[model samples]
Target: MLVLTRKTNEAITIGEDIEITILSIHGDQVKIGINAPKKIDIHRKEVFIAIKEENHEAVKTVSLDSLKNFIRKS
Candidate 1:
C-alpha cells in the first residue's frame, strides 16, 4: 500500500485524471475531497464490499427455471 502524509489543502494525484485532496482535519478524523470524471465511480471500502456481497447474493437466489416461468407468463 502507498501511504503518504498530507496536511489540510494538500493534494495527491492519481494518473492524469484523478486528484484527492485533504479538506480539513478535526481531532483524529480527516475530511477529503476527490476530483474525477463523472464516468468514474467512487465508494468507501465498506460500501463497495457491501455492494459486491449484495450482488453475489442476488445472483445465487435467481434461477433459470424461475426466469423461464416468468417469461412464459409474460
Candidate 2:
C-alpha cells in the first residue's frame, strides 16, 4: 500500500482523473474530500463491506435454480 502524510488542503491525484484531498483533521479521524468523475464509485470501507455482505446473504438465500427453470419454460 502507498502511504503518505498530507496536511489540510493537500491533495493526491489518481491517474489522470481523480483527486483526493485532506479537508480537516480532528483527533484521530481525518476528513477527506474526493473529486472524481460521475462514473466512478466512492464508498467508505465499512459501507462497502456491509453492501458486499448483504449481497452475499441475499444470493445465498435466493433460489437461482428455480428462476432458471422458469426462464427455460418461458
Candidate 3:
C-alpha cells in the first residue's frame, strides 16, 4: 500500500478524475471529501465490507433466477 501524509485542505488525485481531500480534523477523527465522476463510487472501508458481507449472505439465500421470477410477478 502506498502511504501518504496530508494536512487539512491538502488533496491527492487518482488517475485523472478522482480527487480526495482532507477537509477537517478534530482530535483523532478526520473528515474527507472526494471528487469523482458520476460513474465512480466511493465507500468507506467498513461500509463496503458490511455491504459485501450482506450481498454474500443474500446471494446464498436467493438465486438470480428466483429474483427474476419475483420481478416478473411484480
What TM-score do all the candidates reach, one by one? 0.84, 0.83, 0.77
Model 2 local distance difference test score: 0.95
Q: Which of the two candidates, 1 or 2, achieves a greater lDDT against the reference?
A: 1
- Name the lDDT value of residue 51 in candidate 1: 99
Collision pairs in model 2: none
lDDT of 1 at 43: 98
What's the distance in Å from true for residue 8, model 1?
0.6
The best candidate by TM-score is: 1
Model 2 scores a TM of 0.83
Candidate 2 lDDT at 43 equals 95
**Tens-digit lDDT string for candidate 1 (1-74):** 99999999999999999999999999999999999999999999999999999999998999999989999999
Candidate 1 is scored at a TM of 0.84
Can you list the residue pairs that collide in candidate 1? none
Distance from true position, residue 45, model 2, in Å?
A: 0.7
Off by over 4 Å in 3: 63-74
Q: What digit string (tens of lDDT, one per residue) describes model 3 on residues 45-72?
A: 9999999999999889998899999999
TM-score (C-alpha) between model 3 and the true structure: 0.77
Worst lDDT window (10 residues) for model 1?
Answer: 59-68
For model 2, residues 1-74, the per-residue Cα lDDT tens digits are 99999999999999999999999999999999999999998999999999999999988886989889889999
